[model samples]
Target: MAIWQHGGMPSSKNTQFAVAVHVLTYLAGQVERGPVSSDELSASTNVNPVHVRRVLGPLREAGLVCSRPGVHGGWELATPAEEITLARVWRLLQGADPVLGLHGPNPDCPVGRGVQRSLAAIDGAVAEAVAAELERSTVQDILAREVQGACSVPGQA
Candidate 1:
């Protein structure tokens, strides 16, 4: 029932958060360039174009992105970057999926049952705390930070 582990539990590699962030950052950087194609975004993200479309589908439906059809078709942010918060995107992508996961434990084992119950009670508060933090920053803020890093050299910022 001790779900937290130091090494054995591997983190998710291709998380939706990472993909969304990458796509948003690319779009943010293209402010003067206009709409971007999924193939172009996928190339930059190193993910398949089909998979990029899958990730963008929810974003488009959520009003975070707008898509154009036909020959000149592509994707672009529906609202300004400053209006979109990381929390909003994360919540949309993970709808109904708990931010924290718990595994079923042996009901007959007293310790397992107790630990599971305790963690279940605490998970909501933990997820809420994470959301509060994410809500404080916008995609524009993240873009600015990324640009700052690019401008920095070695020990300077």
Candidate 2:
């Protein structure tokens, strides 16, 4: 499954990667609180609770988050927010899907065959670049920027 779409650039409104980051960032911000329910997470993401649960499945298996069952049961980070790099989340969600959303072209045409090979190479490079850049930041970095007013935007105050 594609973790990111929109020509390999993460479209927060459409991608699971974005939702995962949002969920993790919210969890990180609630570090002092108890486990957060899927309903609350879904509300925060403006997505269905089922979608929140689906996104949490991989995160849970990857040991990034853990869940509890019962009335007061909910989910919480299994790993520290500072240790969960965006790159790690990307890989876990990325799986074996093409980062650039490549598709099979007309193999009968020489141009199409050549373009496929070229794109495949470029796709690998782009994926690596994405991971490397994401490695520089963690969930905590995003949380800090959001909650602590650590605005990196120019003239945004």
Candidate 3:
């Protein structure tokens, strides 16, 4: 499960960000193969094909993936797998946003005046943590370790 799915507030739009990353990562590994259909992705994600298409657009715009039309058409990554890093993926999907945004406090209260500043500091810390983690990971790393582990059997081909 994702962090935001557990009731933790997300700085970015959760569904779009997750879906974009998932779709891009899926594409990154399949570059040598033919385009992957949205229906295939939909089945894996258990999401609607329309939803998958919608999420894929931004990635396409970011030059992460390219889509084809007509029969045997779908999507594939535009760049080499090793060239795509988690930070690139995150920026493509989530853009640059503090992990948490400060909400305005009650204006009449004295504490409210300082609350935004405090939240700004907290947001900075959250952004630093997120950046550090993202920097440490790449999409290829995620694919070789995380996704491969889930799909491959133990001591098997």
Candidate 4:
């Protein structure tokens, strides 16, 4: 198997970002319905509930989600889904870093120095493109489509 296929290129950080997006999109649909338990989300994602809560901690601080405590308590979106764009989600999860951080080039070669600079520029452009694409999507958009698909079958909840 290729190194990337074996978990080479996309780091844990990227995975966490993706998970956060999925969780947020899921919660957006449940906003009007009611709070969703982390266990339920974990079951849907096939991940541990602890991991889900760990990731959700940041979103909560960002004011994207609100949690309650009680027998029926769980989490709900803090804001309207349409008002929360994917760009906002990415920013909340990834912070202000470039999507790709730079690594120091070989100090022994002039070419390496130049390549590092060029790569940094490319990374900046890629980050901008990513942000632009994310900005075009909202949690509402993803949830509306996905929830409908999941609920399409009769007797399926």
Q: What are the models' TM-scores? A: 0.77, 0.79, 0.74, 0.76
- Which lDDT tens digits does candidate 2 get at residues 9-102? 3323347899999999988877667788888888778789899999889999989999998987889998999999999999888865667767
lDDT tens readout by residue for model 1, 96-154: 55456676666668998899788877877777787888899888888887743342122
**CA error at residue 8 for candidate 4, angstroms:** 14
Off by over 4 Å in 2: 1-14, 148-157
Local accuracy by lDDT, each model? 0.77, 0.82, 0.70, 0.76
Worst 10 residues of 1 by lDDT: 148-157
Tens-digit lDDT track of model 4 for 50-155: 9999888988998988988799898898988888888877877676565675655556679978997898799878878998999998888888777354522233
Please give the RMSD of candidate 2 to the true structure.
8.2
Best by the TM-score measure: 2
Instruction: In model 3, state the lDDT of residue 13.
Output: 55
> For candidate 4, what is the TM-score?
0.76
**After best superposition, candidate 3 residue 101: deviation in angstroms?**
5.3
Candidate 3 wrongly placed segments (more than 4 Å): 1-13, 96-98, 146-157
In angstroms, give how far residue 15 of model 1 lies from its true place.
Answer: 2.2
Give the candidate order by descending lDDT: 2, 1, 4, 3
What residue pairs clash in candidate 1, if any at all?
none
**Candidate 1: stretches off by over 4 Å:** 1-14, 109-114, 148-157
Clashes of each: 0, 0, 0, 0
